[model samples]
Target: MSMWIRIDDGVATLALTPPADRAVFRTALIEARGAMLSWDVASGQRFPDAEIHSPLEASAWLAEIYGEEIAAAVRAAAATSLPVPGSAELVDAAHRLAWLMWASDWWPAGVYTPALNGPILAAETAVAAHAVEHLLDDEDAVERTLHQAVDAPSALAAVPLRLRADAAALLDVLTGLADDHGIALSAATVSTSSADWALAAGARGQIREGIEIGHGLAPVRWADVPAQTVAADSDARWSLRHIDGVPHLHVSVAAVPVAAVPSTEAPGTEAPGAEAELWARFGPESLDIDIPLQGDSVGFTGNMQVAASIALLPLEERTLWIRDPLLAAVPGPAESEDDRDAVRAQASIRLDDPDASLAERAAAE
Candidate 1:
């Protein structure tokens, strides 16, 4: 495959002709971008721009980063004017493998997106590493390099039993790739067998079951509320409940679908009295709570639980005013018993008493 490089406005771009080579080149470029270059801020330039211009120069640079085997392949391809001797599937799989590696570092764990369990992450990384190795015939080179960085398993193990179906599906993909490439995946088979036996023997215990908060809460319009403090499609709810012989008031506001509301203020300008109004609204005894944009929605829940006296207010006084009553994401035709249970479960958690019964927490705020 032919490699082309272009530079404009201090940005560098590399392009490879033909789709298959382009995929492989993109993957390698992702690998190189992080480690291969250093910036000279004083000179406003990057060092060693020379090795990136032609295929021969690129191969020499690749040798320093990815070792001689990959570099030799690139050199051979450039000389013969032919694409690399790897299938499109291998390139695609390798790209995905690289992404999973990056996800291990940069995934934003939150309420909707739960933190990656350590063993599960390790097992997934191990599977992806093995698949890349088989696809590239690299003899565990990728796996070994990854192990040096993180505690990536040499062989997949400790996969939770609940995730066996998912693991099997991943292995099935690897198996198909192996079949297409005419390679035997003995390591993967052995690893799978061991994991299955361990699961059957209860060697690795089950993943901890936690109550999924906000399970049935629907997105409501911001304009529905009198204050309009939250963004559109925000999940907002308030309730008063008795918990463990004590009353509690629970209020929650979650920016659903999107984590944060975009700022409406113009550049280099602050809205007049906005900061003062925000402070007043979020101050003590106020019904509104400041839900930080960066944090999970659960951060805004149960803010008024300490001011339980609000629960003693008359139903008319405590009523949540809605400007447009029907402006909500409608649930199914009828709420099922399970839906009711989920709502009760969520309400109990928000009321700051996990053991409270549904009947005790019936009233809405």
Candidate 2:
């Protein structure tokens, strides 16, 4: 199956024959945006896609946006097939287009920091595209393109002084994309290097307490727990926290496999799905638990309300146990509030200053 873009009447529509995978869809969108950028750069015309809409004055709007020559090229390309320019310049422009789209959704704008100028960014992308168009085969093309684009008087120079750093960061990303085009095409692989990738991959989740306890509780070794049932690096942990002056017991299992609690079916009987079995035993409504297992590595996070009773027991008698469906307990030391707070603070600071060094942003909860 192949994906194509069509401009019928006055509206542009992306049509995929049958249906394509997410990677194909993503590549199609990027190529479409690159085609728009390439046309604008070649014709020296500025027309954002958002401004054009179907109306009674369709001809005027279309002329304002696509002009005549470029409009004809778009119609020709749509009738045939979208041009897939695998050159570094076009790839770099496509990456910039992707980032600009993402920034429209998630760019952080504070009192001091302003929102990204889309037109300006688009213009800079065009300039950078031209600067690197012929340098695709150069050994140091990425760096050279970065320098040429930054030094030239274009949209990059027009960006506000306060937002220049942010703009420069975008330039860095574009250069990196120019250097390695493969990373730009892969949508499934989450790269920690760029916030755009992480955001696109859904890696950024809700903020949670990160507790690291070193002392005060001993590790509880379990001989009955089978090795095959647990995932590699599996660990059962517990934390005691005073939330709003009430003690709460937070329990978690890291890297636990779906088979942690095997089915109790007869030797040859068919069993339910792993998810169905897991929900039957530890469903959120039944146990007030959180099972955020979307991949092979199963995990659990739940709080016990009877934490005060457990905390009142002697240090050695404070052992936790579970049976029937699954036989398990806290296999590691109890976490401390201070440690959790420290981790949470670091996370908060990191959210604010993503560019900050890990060591420098370590002091937070």
How do the residues 198-230 of candidate 2 rate in per-residue lDDT, one tens digit apiece?
100121222244332211322212222322122
Cα error, residue 147 of model 1, in Å, equals 8.2
- The 10 consecutive residues of candidate 2 with the worst lDDT sum are 191-200
**What pairs collide in candidate 2?**
344-365, 345-364, 345-365, 346-364
Candidate whose lDDT is highest: 1
Instruction: Give Cα distance to truth, residue 145, candidate 2, Å.
Output: 23
In candidate 2, stretches whose alpha carbon ends up further than 4 angstroms from where it belongs are 1-3, 7-10, 14-78, 82-91, 100-250, 253-282, 286-302, 306-365
Q: Model 1: what TM-score?
A: 0.28
Looking at model 2, residue 6 earns an lDDT score of 56
lDDT (Cα, 0-100) at 118 in candidate 1: 30
Worst 10 residues of 1 by lDDT: 198-207
